[model samples]
Target: MHSPGAIQPAELWRLFMRAMAVVDYARPLELLHVPAADIPAGHAWIRVLACGVCFSDVKIARGQMPFSSSLRLPHIPGHEICGEVLEAPGGFWFQKGDRVLVYNYWGCGRCPMCRIGQENLCLNLQGWVGFTNPGGFQEGLAVPPERLLPLPPGISPEQAAPIGCAIATAYRAVVTRAAVRPGELVGVIGVGGIGLHAVQIARAAGARVIAVDIDPRKLELARVFGAVAVLPEEAEETARRWGDGIGLDAVIETVGHVHTVDLAIRMIRRGGRLIGVGYRLGDMASIHTPRWVLEEITLMGSRYALRHEVEQAIRLVAEGLVRPVIDEVLPLESANEALERLERGQAIGRLVLQVGSFSGV
Candidate 1:
């Protein structure tokens, strides 16, 4: 949120797009210039068009991606990617030149979760695009053929990437954690990429959405996306003023800050539900259990979306229920710059690396 708008904030969008990859010296993404690889049987690679930037990418660039990894130096940092298939190993469901959206999480197919068709939370996922494996901030990508989903006609690649990550994550948190219902009221905290989508999808599910964000600009964006009204840390006063209120029917906490979490807890009605969606680091925030027990509050943790859930997100985009907000996209040449923007809270929606673009069937 711009402070009063009378003051123009510094760098509404960052100018740098540089990154020191895990495998290479800090370099401009364009200068590094990696080549696309051929697809071998049972493997698939994509020619990346647009890849949405993510908070986790910021962590990985700073050595934050989890697991004991032998990350190739010069690793590309992007996960929310959308494009057409360049090559597909046999037995895969795709073909060359089909518009597609990628599922970011990678899991082994034999695991129970995968066996039941949930691979996004894979137990033995080798590596996700932009984390351990080569990602989409390049001209193309090589992925497990099964992880790619064919997109409905007319869905732009730029729009697809955000849904793959931001939209899917929010959708999963609401459906799996919040268990939202029609006509219920939803109090959503942190109205950025994930937060904004939580509002739209909750509204799509028939819930009246009330958005909370520190920035007035972001809250304005939330209102544009159909939020009933934006709460600028002023909902506490509003709630008290509206005497008929019983807090919120559901609260989705996308902010990891301790104070924000406490506020989210206080905003929900008794018998409410809260989902923690942010990928937080360090010590966990202290949550008092007595209030949760006495009020019968429900809390759940949602990771990435599974296959079916991801499909649902794609459909939401196709139907125009939600739209991805892209602040800036660098050419992988600006990885460090992108991450820095994330660190400084200067980016909106998901920042992306425009690795390369192509046109074909």
Candidate 2:
């Protein structure tokens, strides 16, 4: 294999699957052939191995996500990418055949947030791959070298792919943002991809975990992921069962619905924290302002993982402290089915698309 730093041809064609339109509900993504020369500058060429299908992708494909208007059509909709470095610009450190995972956040590096190592919250944001920019639903990826994280040994590309977003986002919410500590009771709402990982990360942080979801299968999987208590979506009933009608220490809400937000707030104890990681468009929830002030509850929103947080999340997976839960592995052509599963909330942990075969680390 040629090294990523080795320069060769300027024009190469690659086969890729991409969402051709947002209006078509029957089929949103399809395969296409595009020239390598069309890839944006300052990006390394990577052979995409696997990409995880996130609920955000489903929303984007359906034209339901916030800022969905910014997406250019014929777009590829996958952000959690695992790939092998095929080529890199001069001075780039990655080499050919090196396994790596793409960090979904791409930011203007000169901003204060980027300077502080929080590129995911960049003030002058460029756009997230798979959302605003070209993503890894295709056979290859053009990624900024700085956005690539090395794939740890013993973790296959398929396993590490979901870590790019699902695990990384959960770790940031539970470990970095929430700062969950030992003996604290942490509640995870909606045990889907990110929520399931949140339960594991909270448990690994030594916090007692309580997970709530409408699906019984997901709740059962949450128990397997180390959640001490699992409950249905009835927040009132859940609150009654835990802490003797008091509340929880922290609640991570992954399903961004009006009622879920209300439920999260209702189940929090005084001086507790609620971190929101989900986004629902055109939906509003009301909170009792007086109660919020009196109870001293902190409501915060967490986006994707920071660069350092993504690295930390990867290390946790490498050490076996956390594992990526994959509900199904499908081919690139099965992207529609994967998205449909996510839209229906049928996937337990994550649905990954194996875009291309990898030789392993």
Candidate 3:
């Protein structure tokens, strides 16, 4: 077990850890000292190595998401976490110094959804890391042993960080919810961080993917990831032409705007599926009920991935099937700058924050 030099374990909880906090909505995160909390009986104290900056973090920071109102002030926001175990209780699968990727969701274990391995859909969620509780934007975190997933071989902490959210969420949308079939025509709207990953995942599933975005750069990146890129105006025409004049077999909408949802619904053929993987508070989409009934179109909402899906996503990365595209890496102190870049639509892929050094592992 790793110790804090000459200091003892009893003194660890008394020390302060450096962290970035959101003191107010629509404001920059401020650097502050956070008191370390005592580790519970079944929990472990982790030293954070890296955290991915998600657009959801941007929304939460700007108070644009529905959960923003419930968020406590001075909360640390970072869900995609990769870290090392500094201290863990006995009789657990992992020990101290082990590299781990956090699953983020802490569901009520007794709930019906959680009983069936669907913890992401738990009826009574206990806490979600970086959302309902303190997150990995700090030097250290207290996490339950069950929420920690083993970081497989051949992946760095920085690369593995986003697997907790972006890649896994895309995996759930494309593989689990949509069940994309080989030789199918798939349309992915809003080729941003998650959308780009969705494009790659669908292609890896043997489907022909068409990526739609307003930005030329994102579309170009999607093309590089093995998708036929198209603009918003050209999406419907391209989908019809590509799907042999019917429409796309499935549409994965990652932008929750009403306009994007409408576009996604319009791109689907008869009996096609529309998977909604993103959303904004108070935004609603209107569907034409007559056409919907006649076409038998299906609309589904995909939350985050299940635990096994996250493991599969890790395996995909470890085996070199899909690669997480990261735009830049910055020090933890540059979090505000990274969020600004994301807010301005300047990030092509994901931006990560390196919180601590990862060496000899």
Go through the candidates in order and give the C-alpha RMSD of each one to the true structure.
9.7, 3.4, 2.4
Q: What is candidate 2's lDDT per residue for 1-361, written digit by digit as tens?
A: 2333443443132432232234343466766664444456777888888999998888778877666666567677889999998778778788888899998878999999889887877899776888877788887777889889897679988899999999999999998889899988889998899998999999999988888888889988888877855565565566657756788889999988988888888888888999999878788877799888988989989988887888999999999999899999998878889988887878889999998776433
Error of 1 at 203 (Å): 1.5
Off by over 4 Å in 2: 1-27, 38-42, 233-235
Per-residue lDDT of 168-246 in model 3, one digit per residue for the tens? Answer: 9999999999999999999999988899999999999999999999999999999888999999999999999998999
Clashing pairs in model 3? none
- lDDT per residue for candidate 1 within 67-164, as digits (tens), equals 41556666766778887785677776798888787877778789886787767667787667777776766665567777888788877777787888
lDDT of 1 at 172: 94
Instruction: Assess each prediction's global lDDT (C-alpha) against the native.
Output: 0.72, 0.82, 0.89
Global fold similarity of model 1 (TM-score) = 0.85
In model 1, state the lDDT of residue 317: 86
Q: How many clashes does each candidate structure show, in the order listed? A: 18, 2, 0
- Top model number, TM-score: 3
Error of 2 at 318 (Å): 0.6
* Number of clashing residue pairs, candidate 2: 2
Count backbone clashes in candidate 3: 0
